[model samples]
Target: MNQVGSLIFLVALFLFSTFLNWYVFQAYKTVLSGVDSERSKQMLNLIYWIVFGGISIWVVYTFHQIFKAGEISTAHQQVLNVFLTIVVTQLVCTIFLFGEDIFRNIQAGFSLLVNGKSETSFPTRLKWLSIIAIAISMVPFTSFVYGITKGKYNFTVHREIIYFDDLPDAFDGFTITQLSDIHAGSFKNLDAVKKGVDLAIAQQSDLFVFTGDLVNHEAGEIEPMIDIFNKIKAPYGQFSIIGNHDYGDYVSWESPEAKAENFKKFIKQHERLGYKLLIDEHVVIEKDGQQITLVGVQNWGKGFQSKGDLTKAMEGVASENFKILLSHDPSHWDYEAKNEPRKIHLTLSGHTHGMQFGIETPLIKWSPVQYRYPNWAGLTAYQGRFLYVNRGFGFHAFSGRVGIWPEITVIELRKK
Candidate 1:
């Protein structure tokens, strides 16, 4: 499921660049087709500014990412941030630039039909028509970009669940902190990662869970910052499950053996950080005489092929215990996900990253992922179970959260 998002997100940027440039080129061609009057020359000059300069800026940013992808440091982190900001701004600007011409074209079309000007200049007629489709689609894309940048991420908890039966009476007020999709990359450095872990610790959570994507594609991208997460403290335990990114599938692997070795190493890294890595297994957390089951599964998704084996994970388990699932993608919930025959009471997932863009507010919130999952963020009830789609403690390819600030979900599990 995350791979779907990654492919779409990466494709969106590329298609947008290609199509935008094409439309602009088409518009530039029209402007030049007419006579070389003062107005034609003026329009040509303005069009050149938009085309050549835009291409130049685009080239610099793309090359910058290529050049700096291997060097993960504080300075490069800043560079990535600025680079993303510029690209995002350009995405927004392109829609508007293309749209303006589109609107003008529509007006010209209508003018030709009603006023009967069949012989309108090629430049005048073509510019408007070339931009018509671009303008319409840009409306929604612009709205998405604007809503994300301006802060509009609206979500709600699902209604299939009411409460957890195994929550201790004394723990009616207990809050567990959940972190997910912390991709720590060239964009996110040690200090930023520390700030998130530190904030999670400050919640004084009864338990803490990281549901994968601790690092983007590279396991060692976070090696230098391992000690920072090791600083996190929790009473019950700090648990983690692997996300898709942990599998080393993002980069080429020499052999199946190498990929397996890398995944094992990632598990070891989490242990070094004082986290109890749950790879298709469950551990009982007991307080006083009461106990709850904490289950961890590998990255599983309905649309993505991966190593998550939920049944094998629950194999030796007794159904009497209260279970909290630490799976990566929310789509797992759809596979009878949270509502599977196993009767999982609470599931924590974080692969969505809230799309790393969008706004969460009292009303009218959305993200590119909203089209996929219903509970893309926060606590929700599902078929008599609970699922928390955490917004995540870290950012990925894009640094800043346009509207949805990174979240540290403190979920309170109260006894019925």
Candidate 2:
């Protein structure tokens, strides 16, 4: 956006945050009104402003740094996460307080109509109502804190078995372990990351594939963890495709040449990790003298990068071949892959990260990202074509995962 537009947006956000702070403060006072110790009340008020006001100032400073540098450092990202958590918690409390005020006004209006005179004083704030609001707000406050502390490294494995009538007999019972979105720049704990890599290695799948997003902004981000990731090797082969972030488009560079150099390094990093990086190409995996086609395309989503050419990737491969496609964005399936006349048997993608937060259980699976992408996470089939969207092997923008932990997917392919 233009400079003026950015300034206006920041100002508007500051004003809204200030209003929430003031409104929540009223509820705080009501909840503490019964306390007789003036000193204790004064101390509590001081702590409240120190946290809310301090975080607000930090947020403004972080934004300034981002605007100037065209990048958000890890420290700045964490500060933003903390600010978001506090704002959400305060908004929850504000809802209850606002409702109480409306009820108070209605009661006063009823009294005036009955008595033929306005009440001399407003009704006292309901201490219990405020107390309940504060108590409930803690749920989100604690959840965000836990997410930042531990949830990001909590890797979970998801297993799926898919059967295909047209599958090659030699490829039956073939197991493929898939990972996606290893935003290496966002990782802070190396040991924890290694543990996740080890878990993927232990899966012992026949083929290993990474869908995309090896790094967040630049290739340098993955340099530190190369050894850990290289440990993930499969018997058939390890293959990968590029995601939108791997192009280094999110951050500014000194020149076009510098950005191009970064892109080159990113591709090399894939080679260094022993992955056959496929840029709109196909590779044949032969087992027991029979074969299946594995086609990989560059980032191709509805709104994001549309560089992947399915036709070029599938060239020379017959339409009757049992095919598995490596695509970074699930929207590719929604927009192109699933609708192709040649019929791709399976497509793997992992761009959404399930918003890194949502509830997933046996009965209900919901995330805010589902509204934007039809196939946000897990397995979904459309007209006999299947798409498996991995939740991601790492965290990003938010710095943590809440209900949806980082994922490693093991998919077994069987002949029907």
Candidate 3:
């Protein structure tokens, strides 16, 4: 957005947040009613406002920097993370407080109608309800703190064994390690990142594919960690396709040539990292005289970039050959890949990052991203074709992840 538009948004957000804080303060006062020491209560109230006031200043400064630079630095992102955490926690508290207020007002109204007089001077705030609200608010408060401190780097490996009826005999049990959305610019802990890379290397899969989003905005973001990622080598080869962010579309550039130069550097970084960057192209992986097609396309999605040319990428490849597609966004599979006449046996993707937050368990696997992209994370099959959306290897706009931790996906292809 333009500077004026961004400024207006920030002002509106500030006003809304200020109102939310005011409403939540009522709950705080009710919860503190039992405190014996007036001084202590006063001090506590002062501290609460001070903390939120400081957060407000930080947020304004961070946005100002973003407006000036056309990009958010890692430090600025952390500020946003903290701001979001606080706002969400306050909103949770507001929900409970608002509900209780509604109930109390209704009770008061009923009493006035029935008795012809108000039973009480005013509806007293329920201390116990306020306490409960505050207590529950801590859950998300602590979770957000932990997510920032540890969850972003808590790289989890997800393994899926996909069965295919037309799979090549030589390719049975073939494992492909997939990583996506590295967003190298967001890395804060190099040692932790190295551990995730080490884990990917330990998988020792036959092939390694990075779906996309190597950097947040520019190619230079990964320059510092090229060697760290280069460690992820496989027996077949390491291949990559572009993501929406790699084109430098999110940030401002002095000229079109500058943006083009940045993209060129991004492509060069892939080469330096020992990955064969594919743009609307296909590579055949041969094992024991049998071949499987690996088709990669540029960032194609339902709402994002649609530069990926599936037909062009599949040219020359036999329709019967077992196909594995490297697409950044799962939407591509939902909209195009799965319905292709040539029949893609498998498509690997990562762009959602499972929204970096959600619950995933044996009985419940859910993230907000699912509402946007149906096949968000893990394995989903349609008409015998499989799509595995890796949660991502790094964080993005949000400085950290919550329940949906960073992921390294390993898919074992088995012949049905």
Alpha carbon lDDT at 42, candidate 1: 78
Candidate with the greatest TM-score versus the true structure: 3
For every candidate, C-alpha RMSD to the true structure in Å: 6.8, 2.0, 1.9
Query: lDDT per residue, candidate 2, 295-396, as tens digits?
Result: 999999888989999999999988898899999999999989999989999999999999987889999999989999989999999999999999999987
Off by over 4 Å in 1: 1-162
| Model 3 Cα shift for residue 69 (angstroms) | 2.7
Q: What's the distance in Å from true for residue 23, model 1?
A: 5.7
lDDT head-to-head 2 vs 3, winner: 2
- lDDT of candidate 1 vs native? 0.69
Off by over 4 Å in 2: 37-43, 98-123
lDDT of 1 at 95: 58
Candidate with better TM-score, 1 vs 2: 2
Compared with the true structure, all predictions reach lDDT values of 0.69, 0.91, 0.90
- CA lDDT, candidate 1, residue 65: 49
Model 1 — which ten-residue stretch has the worst lDDT?
Answer: 151-160
Q: Extract clashing residue pairs from model 2.
A: none
Q: Write the per-residue lDDT of candidate 1 for residues 120-231, one digit (tens) a residue.
A: 5323434455355345445545544553343222221221223566666666666687777777664334555566667677778788888998877667777887888788
Estimate, for each residue in 1-416, the C-alpha lDDT of model 3 and write its tens digit.
Answer: 78899889789877877787788899988888889999999999999888887687778778878888888888888888988898879988999998988998998888788776745455798898888998999988898999999989899999999888888899989998999999998996899989999999999999999999999998999988998999889999999999998889988899999999998899999999999999999999999999999999999989887999999999998889889999999999999999999989899999999999888999999887889999999998898988889999998878888899999998999988
